[model samples]
Target: MARSIKNPKKAKRKNKGSKKGDGSSSSNSVPSLPVKVWQPGVDKIEEGEELQCDPSAYNSLHAFHIGWPCLSFDVVRDSLGLIRTDFPHTVYCVAGTQAEKASWNSIGIFKISNISGKRRDLVPPKATDNESDMDSDSSDSDEDGEVQNGGSAAPVFQLRKVLHEGCVNRIRAMPQNPHISASWADTGHVQVWDFSSHLNALAESETEVSRGASTVSNQTPLVKFSGHKDEGYAIDWSPLVSGRLVSGDCKNSIHLWEPTSGTTWIIDTNPFLGHAASVEDLQWSPTEVDVFASCSVDGNIAVWDIRLGKAPAASIKAHNADVNVLSWNGLASCMLASGSDDGTFSIRDLRLLKDGDSVVAHFEYHKHPITSIEWSPHEASTLAVSSSDNQLTVWDLSLERDEEEEAEFKAKTREQVNAPSDLPPQLLFVHQGQKDLKELHWHSQIPGMLMSTAADGFNILMPSNIETALPSNDA
Candidate 1:
């Protein structure tokens, strides 16, 4: 179902216009230099040295704001094909805003469309160069340049918001039905909202804006639960079952919800109590309907089987500090990833669980606390992580550098980049510029696409180097 889309052959660096004895021109001559490696809290730029992002490093990149900052958001699985690779993409998502005032908070359902950008093939460098020159000469050539050079264009979004009573701590959309979403509020309550009206309005508004302007819903939630002793950041809907859910709270409690009807759920009051401290996050097993996992502030990860009892079936001391997030690999059922407050993350093979030796790999790259982590739906070995250090990193566990390949790469890039020898070989891409990155998720339908949210705004980008294992339209 998946295929590599990139040309393994690297692009040739053209230096026809370079002048001899010019140090300034030497750096600009190397356009195909690898992405500048940045290590937060360790490296600082000296005077006259500046950090600049190479535009060619990304296939597509866009940044936008939605009036208020959102701490949590979920990508809504759409009717679009599960493996969509077309350009000018459209994405649907739901985000719960953390507004300045409690009453100012709202749940925003958005449809972002017309996301156009460059592909890896370069569209012929000569034509692209000419188009860039024309764009620089005249400001009116912006639209024309986009059409002629296949350049990026500003994406547009249509949003329908529902007024809420409190600031939302976390939100998740049902995978089976994207219109039904649940939000955990600071008011110590979890509420589910049906957003069919907003989605319908957005679908209709794409053609005519006036038709969908007044469809915003301010109605009460279809159901609400206040059984938890405190608010939490953990909530996830089961991918295998239609309406099944598991939520954890700061009070060291976990609850399960079973769908009784389309709009109603029966939450079990007898909570699963394995974690001695706050439950930081929860993730359902992709293959097992009766199984799930939870990470806690007490630095323990527990595996639960609802059929067994209220106690966890197995528990492991997963980290030295609070485990902040977890991502269960859907493609590879046995792999589980966890992030911690100590800025380290680890991958554990569930099948290797024996006497607390399940951790197969661990990394301590980020200086600040790890905030979010997610496995790519399209690639089993690939995952993305965001941290409080204002970075979003993509990693591929299947990558390992042999001595021959490392020497070859060093020979090619030695003049352009001075990368540290200790850098992890599995690190594929590192994205900076965002402030206080809170969360990130890969677009399951769109190959290689990733979206991240931060204190400032949101970023949607696709890295140019990583080969997406998918049947790309550009091919």
Candidate 2:
């Protein structure tokens, strides 16, 4: 496990001899508020502002690859960097190849060096569609980084091109395996591929443009699952289990697959179906191996336990409109976050589900439909949300949340089920300056770092005070 970042306890030290809310002073109970201290070594309680990133300057890919093209894509940072020492912190980006379809689609692998300071772009791979079309098969004009023919010897940036048949909807990498990933495509196909050799080769060479091809290398899906009847976008690998996988489609159905033998994966033909409308998204519980949750166009969120049966373990109507996306809180048990087309995002406590008071906090701050939501791995109460409004909001649910606010929320829930108090989760940072934002993900290794993609380009946002933002133990 990574070292837990601890906020300085200078505040607690200052108020060491304090009285408790119980009206007792003998025990030296902590006061309502801790003292404030500004020291040379310790970071103070400072609010962070969003910083826009320049892709070209930080060695990231341009919005367009071959030429200007509109492509539906997915972006995921490889969590393998945390467990594997040799693998650098990298991102796997898959974009639809409408223009470059005949040749190959680009699955760009970017290597990021440092993530502490002003966020810089990773080194996106160098890519050209065709192999034979290469001017020099194994040679380069400039060895010491020179410009030629109105382009740098290798252009500003190039991506390692991985070829697939159709458009890739999502890519879920294995939590334990650094070199394996499962990808679902618009062509109704699911593929599991070992990316070790290819990624190593891509990392070694500075000028190899076309390394990933169908004919060469182990480009085939080690195990392949057929596509859904309609659109198949949702897929996830269980973090608690090695090969337990779940996939959802647009037809209100979901399937679970488990590896049966060596190199053989047994996929259930019959889905664990329950949703009224299309299953929009799915998230495996961070703590439970057999338990998973799904959000649908029907505006309901349902939790299922495969060990118990196909029926839902718990269910709740999460939104008035379609629940577009959701995330299972990794750091805290029993917490789930979801976003809807009604331009509202909510966080719910599963323990309160049976009591009909599941919604703990909600915000209608976005005027457009939310596209993505992700809980921060480093902090339990922190999360990031992106919407069609082309903006991203990073929320710290623990910020300034006193007993009064929580008590009011409980009181409000008594009047109406799922009705939370007026106090919304505090906004730690808001990111604008992008159009039609698609996806946002936290850096697996760093506490306060995140990456987002949009119509214009990708932006890497890092708050200045992420190191000491969340206190180690809440009072």
Candidate 3:
């Protein structure tokens, strides 16, 4: 029987769910189970269908659950120097209830622990027999993993609910300090949290609660910033900057927060504002602390240097479509990549932001809209792009392109005209095993390893071309 929970929409629908997965490695050098191109930890991808139980087929129904469905979450594995192993491990994500009766403000810290021990025998079968062969042949360094509905064992997750006063749009884990993190929500609030203590407290208790019945944190957020209004969609913590944060909202407002005297935190009285529409995402340069980049529905991207005061240090019209997301290259301070709603992504040099033509490379691979992009922290030239079509592709930007191609790349980035006739053959691997992927991130320590979460569930994975996915010995 399912354990009972506190106040929520109570409904008894004869529904079905699957067992959790224990994300682990196989003992045999080449496991026998069939594998797909992508490996997912737990998939909660909801496939909607209008049902007709009775004759009145006009009533469209939706899946109902008392549990707080996952809205968003962050990986705890980003702690610097984290070692990758098949040993038991744990991870966490920030979550919020999608239920109508619940406060849009209720945010939860969700945990999945003991991600070890695979039940190979009980694991569900694969979509095809060749799947196992594909798994055995792929390089371990590159994940290019896969998932099945009834097979993989999932980590047990525990959760704690907290009050945010509005809907949460994003949660970011602090890379410098494993215990510190922050969230941006509809309440126009940026809340900072220190989770070390909470994690320590649950070390002894097997606190794996059901998907949504998360345990409430006894402590409150360490700090909160309430400078913006309306719903906020972007919030990013600087990897190199200690206690530095940047958050954006639907109000077209962006606030930079810093640690203040005593025990408090403060947001600049004036927000950095320039975008004509809602800011979709923001990222801090991995190599520069004060420098960061922001994308917006205004079809532009702007770079800011906090030291330069409130104005954008440089800005450029980046796309014909809304620039939904942008990320800085981990190895190059001035290198940036942006994804748009029109199913395209571009790579550019921030040094040429003032120039109308700044895109160094443009990729039109996904037929569906783009979601997010990340450069490999280990390989300065590698890029990963996720899309709405349930696919992930890792490209090796360092691949040897012909002199003519190189010349054309520079020409396009310089002149901002004549789109490239073809994508340089830097393409490495393509992953098509998951549906509705929401986000993707690389392992902190592992060079090519990656993790992604979808509406179906979350996945711990990477691509298969480990050799090309990283900086080669010859590169």
Candidate 4:
């Protein structure tokens, strides 16, 4: 296990303390104000007026930079069990970078630890009007305030890099063996690598180490395939099977990979042909071993059963514009989520697929293209979405608009948060710190923990209000 440490020198921290009021509008307790809401496209800002983040909306938030911008990344599952509610959490991740030059790109393996803080759960007493006097009279402040008040400790990061030939468009780690990973490069090649050495080095290192230009001699991929005529962004490793993989390309070609040996895979030449335009994304069904899903730029979603041959078993015209991403709900296997280039996302029930009426819910909240989407592994009705508009949103399908509750909430919070009535009631949280938000993933081991990558940097956060069931300690 990776050890936790104090604030790292290379890391820049932006941590805020907790405020008063519980996250409720009950009659007895002073009604807690709702988090201030800001929509990227819907809300307009006046000259010299900038948007500020509501610290009360976050339980624990931390940001770090990896020197280069990354378009896609995967959270590497660690030895930690599925239900982890402990503070000061540690996580491992693998990301491929889009460097300024092709030769500058590399595969980064990260060990981010000591992510401590829980602001949302704390309930301090309401500060009186004499708060200013209290601040002036306080002798112990600064670093002493954190230690005396029991604030969350800052996080630390350690990284290792592996040189790559071209810019990585997308990357994924095998669910069965996280050390074995795959990357799709701009050069129209898919390569697989083993990061066991890097993982071991990070695990054993006692201090933080950030290697930007470090390289090992003869560092080569375990296997490489150049069968795709065009570069692609769609790739997924099947969770049901150990080494079963599916990849699709811009030429509307899809291929399957089967593990031949421990570190080798064989991809068949005959590709699955079901779309007229570019294949945008691919996802393997959570429940079915032989079933998978694919979305295309032609605005169609196809369900493929490998046993049924190259043709898709069923297909549907999912969107008016290009469908960019797909995320299958692992808890509720019947639900499938798709994000489109038109900034709308819809959820469909696989069981109700008949005559093109399978859509159960649709939302057009995002004004820019939807860049990434994923269903939370911990909650059946929860999912997260990222868009080019530089916002990441969390939604709960289980929530519905309650007129009386909404009225009561608005009455109490009207003075604090002036949100538009048109905003969806199901929308739970909106995180807006990064620029050109590209992708986001929920940590399977830690409930409510989310990591997102964008043009600015990476954000690892846990919303204070999102409810997640943590297993009992005795269990």
The TM-score leader among the candidates is: 4
Which tens-of-lDDT digit does each residue in 1-475 have in candidate 1?
0001112221111111100100111122345753344444456755544444444455666666565777889999898688877678899999877776777778888888887765553222344877877644432212111211244455667787898778788899999999999999878899999999888877777742321242445779998999999988888999999999998988999999999999999999889999999988999999999999999999999999999999999999999999999999999999999999989999999998974599988988887789999998988999999988777888889888676966665465353444556768887777765666788999989989889877766778777655444567663
How do these models rank on lDDT, best leading?
4, 1, 3, 2
lDDT of 3 by residue, 1-475 (tens): 0101223333333111111111121122345643211122223322432111110110011122225433456666544245543324455555544334435346555555544321122212443768765543431111212221123344455665666555456778776665676876555677787777665555556755664555454457788766677667688888886777888887788988786732356777689988988888999888777888899988988888999988788888888988888878878877899998888899998777666677888887776677768887677888888888667667777786576864664465342222233534676554443455556776656455566654444555433234232432231
Instruction: Report backbone clashes per prediction.
Output: 1, 6, 28, 0
Superior by TM-score: candidate 1 or candidate 3? 1
lDDT per residue for candidate 2 within 1-475, as digits (tens), equals 0001122111100100000111001111345533221111122234431122321122111122222121234444454444221212244443433333534443444333321122211222345766424523322222211112223223223354456666555666666664567776667777776666665754555542422232322266687787467656678888887878898887887988887753567888878877988887789999888899999888999999998777677778899999988899998978999999877999999989889989999898777888889999888988989888656777888877576865674375332212223424476554444555666777665455566655444555454334345322223
The better candidate by TM-score, 2 or 4, is 4
Which digits, one per residue and each the tens of the lDDT, describe model 4 over residues 86-168?
Answer: 77688999998777777888888889887775533323344676974553343122321111114434566888888878878
Candidate 2 backbone collisions, by pair: 125-158, 125-159, 126-158, 126-159, 127-159, 188-227
Top lDDT: which candidate number? Answer: 4
lDDT values of the candidates? 0.76, 0.57, 0.59, 0.77
lDDT of 3: 0.59
Clashes of 1: 1
Model 1 per-residue lDDT at 136: 41
In model 1, what lDDT does residue 7 have? 21
Q: Which ten residues in a row have the lowest lDDT in candidate 2?
A: 12-21
Scanning candidate 4 in windows of ten residues, the lowest lDDT window is: 1-10
Q: Residue 321 of candidate 4: its Cα lDDT?
A: 95
Better of 3 and 4 by TM-score: 4
